[model samples]
Target chain A: MAARPADTPRGRVPRAEREQQMLDAAVLVFSRRGFHHANMDEIAELSGVSKPMVYAYLGTKEELFIACLRRESARLVAGLAAAADPTLPPDQQLWRGLKGFFEFVGAHRDGWSVLYRQARTQQPFSVEVAAMRESVVEVITDRLDAALRLEGRQVKPDDLTAMALTLVGASESLADWLADHPDEDPGRTATRLMNAVWLGADQLMRGVSWRPPA
Target chain B: MAARPADTPRGRVPRAEREQQMLDAAVLVFSRRGFHHANMDEIAELSGVSKPMVYAYLGTKEELFIACLRRESARLVAGLAAAADPTLPPDQQLWRGLKGFFEFVGAHRDGWSVLYRQARTQQPFSVEVAAMRESVVEVITDRLDAALRLEGRQVKPDDLTAMALTLVGASESLADWLADHPDEDPGRTATRLMNAVWLGADQLMRGVSWRPPA
Candidate 1:
């Protein structure tokens, strides 16, 4: 997908369109060559834009990588938000949301490696990734709160955060596993986690407990 | 806890004891100063050993940090192993393991921060941290397999992995939160996760699924 200038004349292409091409190029290059080995010169060439233009538009390689991280994470967050419809029952909403999230990760294995493997552990970028994660957590907490309210039940803020953290944490751990195992089905993972979590949460909320089998 | 030389002769102390002292100082310094800002001179000074002695015992700052990570993770792993007495039933075993883990994290919040927050996302060290986490996963998986066998039941390896991943990932996420909230009880965190996971696994094994509330 080397810089296709939106069917417009090359020189007259809109700045926004041109910038997107550069970003596309950067994402592909970074994902393939890794952040350190990925060269700006190649990114500029692949995007069909000049080096100075790439710089003027996107700053340095670090800034460009951050841009890629932001775009990819935003795409993920948006997908999750759209998947959980308010009209649906709480359990359906959760199930759909998990399915959608896993599908997105399954489809974008390359994007995940760059965002999670590289950006998550590296400096400055890790902060960005953390902020992104916090947003996802907030979305989950809000949905849980809303779902419980629909049942005319209320949970303490701390308990809600605990529940959200469990979901987010378990999803991330499995997501990392999903990226590693190409043979694994993304939907199955979602189902596995849903089974592991939602059912347990429902049971716990109903005061169900598991004891040692005597 | 600045370097307490044993009551016996200083230079006459055994190599193993000396190394332990150095490791103790390194863990303290790394936890307080972080990886990038931590220096060897301070660690040596704190441990009551010379800077050169630290170099001889540990290779470099990177190696020292790795050593610290290894020791801390080992302590955690051992605590978990010791807590989950196999003589107990499966749920009890799991509950004990999780409680032990969260209690360790709560007690050594600084060690948790260094081992998790810093080592997990940073390079070279991230790989070390992952290896440590894998060992933990193995421990959890093995216990799960044992527990099932006692019940005269068997599970597929992949299913066991998924179950272990859920527990490890959820615990790590909550542990991070636990470190942040000093007021939070470690025992409660363990109980919360057990309710979120173990009960769910027990139900799923019984072929139960959570449906939308009508």
Candidate 2:
């Protein structure tokens, strides 16, 4: 049998391969150009496909954005899920989870940027983006809840969730900040974050006050 | 004297008033529709002026977006600068600055959203936006440095700055979260943030840890 032509379609590639190509292109384009600045034309161009093919496969720009969000969010959440164990000690669990987060973000900086930064800011796309964020928060909150219980502390779920949001937001902001200054080691970055957060959690658990220096 | 028409000649209207009106409209449009999605037409409509009028006053879409960013960022920085004092204890200074931040966000939600959300997400704007963020971080780092110094801590400036960025980011994210969940009071939001952050700072100073439950 003759080898398949490299340039031509091999009896039409599978849907999965096409979708992955689109998503990979979308993540790269969205990260470099951002959501508002990136056009479907450009995305289609980068994917080496016609605009019609892109629309046929990915639906509208909004749907394409949602698909990107879902894929990236799922990846990061899965990575974090593997690292954070309810049964592990609170400190160790937090450390591992942070390391996982930093590692995921470091490896998939483009995907992370698209999900964390681009997808979040535009309108007509915020509800789904917000829902994705809520899902991530739920995961972090679950680990936090277990950690709190493991520490023999019983805080209100809402309050604990809110605090978890604060921690997660800080890490995200730090990730962006860390991107600019890559000289710092990743392990140290994770440890610093864990220290900043675990320090706060400990005080809250023990009912300690942070008084200003005299 | 006869009253003048509202659409008086450019010479008749003070430049300051006209600029302020233009900025107000720009903030609303940019925040609601995003940078690229927001067109000059809507800004002119919302400002009750013609498209030519907007162009004449603000130059171009890019310039107008930058102007809105500068105005809002200056207002926020000025508010925080007024609240932060290096001589004051870190806790007191942080408490005061956070109070100012929540108040500023509550009153100027549109402008705040434009700066914090819209500007940061879109590219070609990140440079200008990062400057604003850096200024805000400067204010935050000042207080963090003092707080750390008081407890005889010797963390590197970059590390402390990273911590401050994390806190600032958490507050920004929380502010957006609060905007949606209106039942949460703004007055107490700053205090809650302080409790979480400052309490953690205190614990870090003392090297305390929250261990797993037996």
lDDT of each: 0.83, 0.73
State fnat for each of the candidate structures: 0.66, 0.43
Specify the highest-lDDT model's number.
1
Off by over 4 Å in 1: A1-8, A201-214, B1-8, B200-214
Residues B101-146 of candidate 1 have per-residue lDDT tens digits of 9999999899898767999889988899889999999999899888
- Cα lDDT tens digits for candidate 2, A1-214: 5764556663376788878989989888877887767789989987778899899999988788888888887887898899887777566677787788887777766666655665555555666677877888899878776766656666677666667778778887888766655576656677666655656623322333222112
lDDT, candidate 1, A19-104, per-residue tens: 88899999999989999999999999999877998999999999999989888888888998998899886767887888888888
Per-residue lDDT of B1-214 in model 2, one digit per residue for the tens? 5886877776776778888988889888888887778899889988778899889888999999989888888988898888877677565677778778888887766666656666765556767887888888987777676666666665578877877887788888778766655577665677566656656633422434222112
Docking category of candidate 1:
acceptable
lDDT of 1: 0.83
Computed on C-alphas against the true complex, the DockQ of each candidate is: 0.44, 0.28
Candidate number achieving the greatest TM-score relative to the actual structure: 1
The candidate scoring highest on DockQ is: 1
* Candidate 2 displacement at residue B209 in angstroms: 15
iRMS of candidate 1, Å: 4.8
Worst lDDT 10-window in candidate 1 chain B: B205-214
